[model samples]
Target: MALKAAAALDVELMSTGAFSIDQLMELAGLSVSQAVYRVHPPSAGRRILVACGPGNNGGDGLVAARHLSQYGYEPTVYYPKHNKNELYQRLSKQLEDLNVPFVNDFSKALADTDHVVDAVFGFSFSGEIREPFPAVIKALEETEIPVTSVDAPSSWSIEGGPPMSGVGSNFHPAVLVSLTAPKPLVKHFKGRHFIGGRFVAPSIAAKYDFEVPRYEGVDQVVEVMPGGKALVR
Candidate 1:
């Protein structure tokens, strides 16, 4: 359902030349903030650390930080670098305008955060985490605070394999806030066991009439072959 909605929106947005990449980034950020609010209700004096990457994922984090600030939560954004990309530059400037404190170091920034928002990676990632970000991942692993990942963990793979499957234990987000539908990586990978034990697909709200149903009754059912006689006495 989430995939369908995302595809629909992608088509509509792509058709319009006016729709820019920045708009999509903002939408993703806002969606993640909403999910955070749903999972962990806002409280007084709570601190949130939003870890952003260098790409659009970082932009999403910046947007979420802005929204979180408006809700009266103190949000600190951490980005790897502020480069020349127009969208990225815009987000950096926005964060500055909002007076949101941000840093490039993962260890120091995550020191006292109550909640960690993983906007460091998105669905577009395919290979292993490179460079200093791997260090950042390692640092996040050591922290005991709850984590909320945006879309899916950065290194998760749709295709079944060693590295793909191996990453399940690496990212243990307390709640995985998917944008549209839950990605195949989120379902196939053991992320539910590790980081995001609570799987949340927020786009379902826009696509479906009823609320997303929780998994139930798997233990109560028994499979029977066609034309087989009942085993019960």
Candidate 2:
């Protein structure tokens, strides 16, 4: 359902010349990084481990790693699978130019990091948890470190968590920034929930019956859920 709506929006936005997918991805990732900064402020020793997948979500992680480095946080990327897609290849090069290390060992990244950014999955993910992803997602869950998921938690259902396959392991995020609008899965999230992607036009919001939270002027992110009930302000 989320993917269908997203596809529709993409067609409308791109065909009407509002924006391209690349542009949207960049904006979304930038907002994700900004939310990460708000939740885990940059400090000398605070390092972030950004776990990325093979899809556009990984592109977002790479983008986040770049911005996090700019914000003074040491960020290492852990992208195990690589797609031949030119978009991802370009993003990888951008991260390389920024000198952000890509760790082959997930455990090593986890050991050296202070926080986790689970960009391993987005709203489009379905099916049973796969091999490497399951292992990696397990690591993210089993750890005591705080995690900040982009869009949605890895292995989570679009409408609810635990996945429709029943692989939920109490994956909790310290912060989540739902691009465009909060997904239904966010109802299960008990941490800080934010709405990003300031470019989402109000008309789209109305069409979707989306009561997108209003951020103070010029703000890129707005907290809609501090804990339980959604807040407008």
Candidate 3:
């Protein structure tokens, strides 16, 4: 459903060649923020560290930070400096308007946070972790706080057949907010065990001709199709 909407939008925008990537980034960010609120409602004060990247993923994080600020939660965003071009500049202006704090260092920011939101990398990512991204991943792994990945866990893969090797350490999120349709790689690589612990994909808009069931109060489970039974612990 989300894919359909995104594809439609992408095609429409590409046809005109006037639409900007920032718009898509904002949509993704808003979608993630809404999912977070649904899973964990905001209170008077709670600290959330949003780990963002230099690409569209970071832009989404910026959007989430701004919305989170509006809801009265203190959100600190960490991102590496890069020439993000005009789209990012626009996002930066928006973040500045919302007064969302941005940091280039992860150590200090991670030290003082209640929860971490992994907006660093998305489905489009491939290959090995490079530079500061690896450092950020390492820092996140060291933290005891719960982490919520926007789409899939960073450094994840679904290829290379069964008995997969070299998958990253399981940083089980208290909740994972998947946009549109869930990424196939996440389920393929991590299997049901990873997602069986608090995963959610929002309901796509009605115009899209599809709907995702409301996951509210739903139990997470792994199912075996042959017997048509759910795995229980």
Per-candidate count of clashing residue pairs (backbone under 3 Å):
5, 0, 0
lDDT of each: 0.61, 0.80, 0.60
Name the runs in model 1 displaced over 4 angstroms.
Answer: 1-12, 16-18, 159-168, 189-233
Number of the top-ranking candidate, with TM-score as the measure: 2
Compose the digit string of candidate 3's lDDT tens values, residues 1-233.
23345457345443553445665566567666665564556762378888887776677777877777777788888878643588777777777787778887788888888777888776566667788887787776667776777666666532321123433454445555555444444344332212221222222234444334333344332222222233343
Residue 98 error, candidate 3, Å: 2.4
Q: Candidate 1, residues 1-233: lDDT per residue as tens digits? A: 34455455445554542455666667667767766765566772368999888766677788888888887778898886655887788777887888888776678878877888888777666566777777777676667887877766655543331142333446666666555344445554333221111222344334343233332332111111122221231
Badly placed stretches (over 4 Å) of model 3 are: 1-20, 158-167, 188-233
Clashes of 1: 5
lDDT of 2 at 111: 87
Model 2 stretches astray by more than 4 angstroms: 1-3, 164-166, 226-233
- Residue 14 accuracy (lDDT) in model 2: 68
For candidate 2, lDDT tens digit of each residue in 1-233?
26677657657766663787788788878888888887778763569999999887878888888888888888899998986888888888888898889889998789888889999988878877676888788787788888989888988878766554444466787888888777778777888888886886778767766665667777787777544334665
lDDT of 2 at 106: 94
